[model samples]
Target: MNKHFLWFFLLFCLGAAAKSLKCITCHLHTQPDRCRRGFGVCIAQKHESCMILQIFQDKALQLTYMVCQQFCRDLTFDFNNRTYVHKCCDYSYCNYDM
Candidate 1:
């Protein structure tokens, strides 16, 4: 009985550890050395991914942002001659490079 209890405890701890999701977050006019906005742990009830978004105008990067998302869909659209790109991932700090 004691051995079973210990095994259950260990598994419970492991399960808890596996559920945490960390992601980098930032908003910048241009690429920066680090996430100047901040880093955050994902806690949204249905959101299990991180996202990085960029918008460009005249081939120059105009805006960028990172956030936790429910789903990461690769999407592109244009408005006012600016192009927007979005990338999403499901690992800790996956948006760090964006």
Candidate 2:
């Protein structure tokens, strides 16, 4: 009983350590420095606009082709795979939701 308990405890600790390392690796590549979320970009926008702008940054020009090819999945008018599908701009006198 003691041996099995020790083995299980060690395995749990190792699994936790591996998860932390995985988070660090993915965050280092996909996120910027000075992160609060510690793994994603910090974009400030109106709550409505965040989804639209995020898509542009992720997909780029391919946003125009919305046929959902093998490369692009989860297509939507405003969001794609948790990213926004268009650019957001601050233009005076115009409140477009793009």
Candidate 3:
């Protein structure tokens, strides 16, 4: 029983950690003073490092958001018609609309 509990705990932690992987390779090098929109489209910077890790579950539709930064956020989409808003802290916050 203890072993099973330990495994479940670790899995939970890993799942949460993977959801918020940072795009440091792309966003960290950007100018700190510029107002970069989602995917940095407004700054003329080409960054493709943004990603949404492990979001799909079943065939159902959903909306999700990710935190971008202290002053920005990101949006996600699915088969639904609602706009999911994310704060700057969530991992999917920097993902661009598709």
Top candidate (TM-score): 1
Candidate 2 RMSD to the correct structure = 15.3
- Candidate 2 per-residue lDDT over residues 4-71, each given as its tens digit: 99999999998865533111101212223232332332222232212221234445432221111112
- Cα misplacement distance, residue 30 of candidate 1 (Å): 3.1
Q: Estimate each model's TM-score.
A: 0.68, 0.23, 0.30
Q: Which stretches of candidate 3 lie above 4 Å from their native place?
A: 25-68, 73-98
1-98 per-residue lDDT for model 3 (tens digits): 69999999999999976654454222322222332333332211223234422133253223222222343434455434344333233234344432
Per-residue CA lDDT of model 1 for 1-98, tens digit only, reads: 69999999999998977777777666553543545555454543465588888988897877788878776788989989999999888777787665
Residue 80 lDDT, candidate 2, scale 0-100 = 39
Scored by lDDT, the top model is 1
Candidate 1, residue 42: Cα displacement in angstroms equals: 3.4
Candidate 3: minimum summed lDDT over ten consecutive residues — where? 39-48
Report lDDT per candidate. 0.74, 0.31, 0.38
Lowest-scoring 10 consecutive residues by lDDT in candidate 2? Answer: 21-30
Cα lDDT of candidate 1 equals 0.74
Ranked candidates (lDDT, high to low):
1, 3, 2
Q: What's the C-alpha lDDT at position 97 in model 1?
A: 64
The deviation in Å at residue 48 for candidate 1 is 2.4
